[model samples]
Target: MLAQTNLPQVAHGAPYLSVVVPIYNEEESIPHLYTRLQEALDELAKPYEVLAIDDGSRDQSFHLLRELAQQDGRWRVVRFRRNFGQTAGFAAGFARARGEWVVTIDADLQNDPRDIRMLLAKAEEGFDVVSGWRAKRQDPFLNRRLPSQLANGLISWATGVRLHDYGCSLKVYRAAVVKQIELYGELHRFIPAIASWQGVEVAELPVNHEARKYGTSKYGIGRTTRVVLDLITVRFLLSYSTRPMQVFGAVGLLFSGLGGALLAYLAYIRLFMGSPLADRPLLLLAVLLVVLGVQLLGMGLLGELVTRVYYEGRQRPIYVVREELNIE
Candidate 1:
């Protein structure tokens, strides 16, 4: 778990809300971001805490965060030793959060803090996850916006959870829903899809997006490859994470069956038709497919063994219980 930087626990019990802001290099926007966020949070008149995660910023961002933590008890800072990306920052914040509901926002000021109310309103209607839709995004089309559109579409199609803007930082989740997610890589944006495995209801709301005013964008085309690879991972976790043999075993069977059929036909031809298979390419193809299929089957068996051993050794429950009946 990532340690908190410079604040003690302010309350005895959990707060009503925990807002997580992952900061990188936004030194210039810290003052205005803090003021506006404070105003918005205070307007709700609810017990809340802010988790400001500085992802090892080389700028004066952590210095500004430390100052804010000193001024207000609600503001808490978690400073990483080095840059580990936004996903790690969010993971660290979630671990330290003690609120009924959690909201994630960016420190770059592109995400509107005032829109927090809208996400809460949507969540009040019994949604486990409420995502912000930046319908009118304010970024360059070629570099930023275009790749985002393609990635969002691909992810939605792959995960069976559709949303207009997965790139939006403004999202709300129930504490229980988020606590179950095991964050790694750049999977922070895929929270809605990841939580869907537990049968969560998801909703989307149109939110405000502002152009960058202070610092440069952290995202680039280089991250597209990572996002695509994680998309494949999310799909696998959704479909066959619990039962690994289903996928690999099915493919392996198909390949092995086809190869066996070809080999049987060649053997019969060689015996009855007196055909020489010494120079034939079909024999080589059949032998290669059989070997590949056996290797795939072996991998599937290993995965199954690992999964079983992991669950048994940890003594962990395989299911999540949202509530219990009187019978219990």
Candidate 2:
């Protein structure tokens, strides 16, 4: 499948901050993104490196990043074999990061690079993870803003993170904290929630958000369904990961109890009141529930076995390392 790789070391020394920008087909925005990002990082007056990940862009994104990396040792580029999604890109960046703090931002220029400082400021308050909140989002009301609002609310309620902008890519985290959380699928949006599981301090701050000036948004309303599905996964990992049987067994018992009560009532009706049972729909319902309950209990047992295998099995890491650039 997909593997991670880095380039030869560029000898920029250890960076105080590592900015990871995942670029996908954003050819026109590269120049502007690089210039503004460098300007912002320069102003911070700290050792920093920009880890630009080209997520199998079909455009000149990789070429642009390569040229920039050659020109500036502080600019490191990682090219993926194919588009493995944003989560994979983040995982690669995190694996190669050698900074005390890591920052993530989109490559579309919508998230101002200058906002990186805002996140870092909040992060300095001893918060392990500092997330950006787009208090006043600049997007269409129907397609972009509405769906995002609903998704953010649902994710907060489900994960108990209570952030207004879970979709914002501008965020800051201590390198150590993020390294502890594994990335997979579309779990990048749930980084805060995942980090919360380690009992880390998480905070949110309002940041500047601008409308897109380059290509169209990669995501749309269709992604909402995927986000909901991933949220279920996150909830399971957070609550029932250590004890899968509790959730499954509890629900299974409820169904089994209801089914047993129904069957008992039907038995009483048939024996004591001389009522016909074969023609009644309640009998079928009871039988169906009982079968379904047993299947659920069996699935619960299977889930426990899988969980053990996941934790105690081969002990493989999530992302594969191909190579690293400018990293010692």
Candidate 3:
């Protein structure tokens, strides 16, 4: 439910490349980021557009973006009414992107814009998605680096997409491939894994990382927990998205079998030894397990119905287009 305004029609023909950047309170870094990004895009000598989605910045970020857009038509700006998170910002950009290839980068100045050429080169080699790996990340060791390392490993292991850096924001994707994916919540962190689900060719390359010179880091330790939860979502969507009943039914059966066995043992003891079931806590535990198992099975059925509704119901898209600039 993102409210968009000032959306303009796209040009007749698509550009060679579109760079989508999500800006969040980066007023201090705007000038440098714009200069470097423009320089990098200009070097390609191809038709390109920069889609700058301002994620409800509390500072003068939007004002500066407007100024840049006015100065150069290649600079397109999209401002959110309020902060909608990074994933929403990216989705907004993707919906309006009219380019053969799309590139995404952070606005903090940490990801070098010059490495974009390398990513584009790799993408030209027939890769649907090219992810950047910050091989030598220049962030705080404990707070940023360590947690990112652990998260990357866990995500790779769970999704079977072995990339060294899942946290890196610099990435390249074919416009068609990116447009097919629906980004929501924190799902942007697992773009590679999600795209791989469609059998897209995904490749990772080492990219240069720079130290932050502007605003404080927006992420914290809490994001690690959120990433773990989102990773579970990604795993479920990858394996059982079409047939959710498989996973839920399997788990429900296991629990039901365990509970049934426990209850049968309790019944045998009660009948054979004449033990009073009312005095044993095991009876209550068994009963609780059986009830929980039944509830889980019911939930699996509900999930199957929900899945059908999602695919067969209204053809609502994952993203809402508020306004687009320089897109056909």
Q: Which pairs of residues clash in candidate 3, taking residues 3 or more apart in a chain or in different chains?
A: 10-327, 10-328
lDDT of each: 0.85, 0.86, 0.85
Model 1: per-residue Cα lDDT over 1-328, one tens digit each:
1124444435445689999888888888888898888789878878888888888789998887777776667777877777778998888778778888999999888999999988998897899999999999999999889999999999999999999899898999999999988788889999999999889999999999999898888989899999999999889989988788888888888889888999999999999999999999999999988887888898889889987986668443222222111100
Worst ten in a row by lDDT for model 1: 319-328
- Model 3: residues >4 Å from true position, as ranges? 1-12, 269-273, 314-328
- Worst 10 contiguous positions by lDDT, candidate 2: 1-10
Candidate 3: RMSD to truth: 4.6
Q: How much does each candidate deviate from the true structure in C-alpha RMSD?
A: 6.9, 4.4, 4.6
Candidate 1 deviant stretches above 4 angstroms: 1-12, 309-328
lDDT of 2 at 233: 98
Encode model 3's per-residue lDDT on 163-184: one tens digit a residue. 9998899999999888888788
lDDT of 2: 0.86
